[model samples]
Target chain A: MTVRELAALPEFEAVCLPDGEREILGGYAGDLLSWVMGRASEGDAWVTIMSNVNIVAVSTLADPACIVLSEGVAPDGDTLERAKEQGINILTTSLDTFDACVRIASAL
Target chain B: MTDKVNFHFDIDGDNFTSAGEASVRIKKLLREMGFSPDTIRRVSVAMYEGEINMVIHANGGSADVDVYGDRIEIILADKGPGIPDIDLAMQEGYSTAPDNIRSLGFGAGMGLPNMKRYTDDMRIESALGVGTTIYMTVKT
Candidate 1:
């Protein structure tokens, strides 16, 4: 599903997504930043509770179309600022990681 | 042919929030230089993992990147407590990072292994009391 479509869903909230309206190809879920760095494919929607500035770097390097911060994960001021600077799509959801992924899969 | 372009960065270990800035910069630089997507991704991922390790374990370090016609080389040097057992450290799911670091979504024991997985070549030189230096290469 496109990032625009997913963000429009009530299941998730668009906290700050400059790229939210873009199309996202798929979902890759992992909390370990390094694992996601190695495993996440370009344009995949990364699902994680890690709300850190490094996630911005990982998303940029991995070329994820969007990052879904699951479980209502609240990134710090630094993370939010970096996310904006990097201009990557970031969404937050109260749903757990599994539920978030399921929602994403169905949307796709 | 031109001389290798070099970039140097001082990683800040005091702030977890600032850790991977160097890798991000390198990734951007490579992209601007028109490195292939796979090569840029591999170099950036390996360097970022090493940068995170330096922050979590070595209390920050220095990173140097050299860009050449055939490949990119990354050198990470740190003075933190050295890894006593390289083999064990290289093993997947083996990490010495503290709980606090883990809470930040790192310290999964996947750092080094993932670094190796992405880079074309990787080498680790570490000591018990001194420090560790990692060398990684990603071919263009």
Candidate 2:
């Protein structure tokens, strides 16, 4: 499914839809940026609670289709701006990491 | 190889916020040069892990990316404390990064291993209390 389609689901809300047209092929759940970088494949939907500026770099390197900030975590201003600049679609959900993973897995 | 283009960057050891800047820039350059997305991602991830290592353990360093027709060579050098055990360092679950770094979403003991995993070739040269230099290459 495309990022736009995922945003429409009740599982998550599109807080920053920088590239909603990108397609989500799978999902990776991790809080460690390095681990995610090593394991996340291209077009994966990265599910995490990380809300830092480095998330932009990890997303860029991993080329994840989108980033889901679980548990209602909010990114800092700088992170949000950088995410937009890099065309990284970020979604937020009230669900915790585990539930968010389940939701994304089912969606995919 | 004489005609190969080279890009150099000085990684500031003091600022964690500025880490990974070089990798991101290189990703853009490779994209503009029409490299395949997979190759760009490999180079980007390798360089990014090296950059993060320099900031977290080496107090910053210098990175030189040599772009050639068939491959991209990345050499990262730092004057910080060197690695004493290369074998241990290469392990997937070994890290010396402080807790603060872990709090920032790094220091999960995957940096060097990930760098090697993404690059075609990797080498580490270091001297105790002198410095460390990492050599990595990714094929186009």
Candidate 3:
């Protein structure tokens, strides 16, 4: 599914998408960095509330297909810019992190 | 088709956010070298965990990576208070990191286990108040 599809899903609404070109997600969530680093597969959609540049760094390391920022939270300026620069698809959903993961897992 | 390549990095302990920079660079380098994506991911994840541990526990450390035809080896050397009980420390859900680190989404006691899970081989050597050194390898 494309990012547009994910946004269109009932679980997500555009909180603050500069552009709607981000792609859809494929996988689920894990908060532990090392756990995500070990288990997250490429092209997976990562759901997390981690709001830091390191989140972006870890996303790149994991090569996730997209990142879904849950709980309607917004990323820092540097994080958004870096994500765009890296061509990483990012989205924001009003759902809390747990709910977001459940919705995404069911979707997958 | 990856030819042998060598790389070294100095992990800075003061800055938690910058911890994975070296591992990210290495991941990029391995990709550019045409290593299979799976192999690159394993090597990168394992090394990244080791790097994070260096920063969190050792205060700082040096990492050496050697890419061979069939495997990638990473040696992490740290000068922090060593792990007194390797057996206990190796248990899942065992961590010395503070609550602050956990809030950052790390220090879940998954670091060492994840490193072992992603790598083909791993070893640790340490002495109290001296430091710790971890050796990990991922088969390419």
How large is the C-alpha RMSD of every model relative to the true structure? 1.4, 1.3, 2.7
Off by over 4 Å in 1: none
Tell me each candidate's TM-score.
0.95, 0.96, 0.88
Q: Which candidate number maximizes lDDT?
A: 2
Q: In every candidate, what fraction of the native interface contacts is reproduced?
A: 0.89, 0.84, 0.81
Over B1-140, each residue of candidate 1 has an lDDT whose tens digit, in order, gives 45799999999989887777898899889899998989988988898899999989888999999999998999999999899999999999999989998987898999999989998899999988899999998888
Q: What share of the true interface contacts does candidate 3 keep?
A: 0.81
Compose the digit string of candidate 2's lDDT tens values, residues A11-100: 789988978999999999999999999899899999998898899888988899999999889888888898888898999999998998
Q: Candidate 3: lDDT of B68?
A: 91
Give lDDT tens digits, candidate 1, residues A66-90.
9999987877788788889989888
- Judge candidate 2 at residue B37 and give its lDDT: 91
Candidate 3 error regions (>4 Å): A8-25, A102-108, B1-3
The numbered model that scores best in DockQ is 2
Clashing pairs in 1: none
lDDT of each: 0.88, 0.90, 0.81
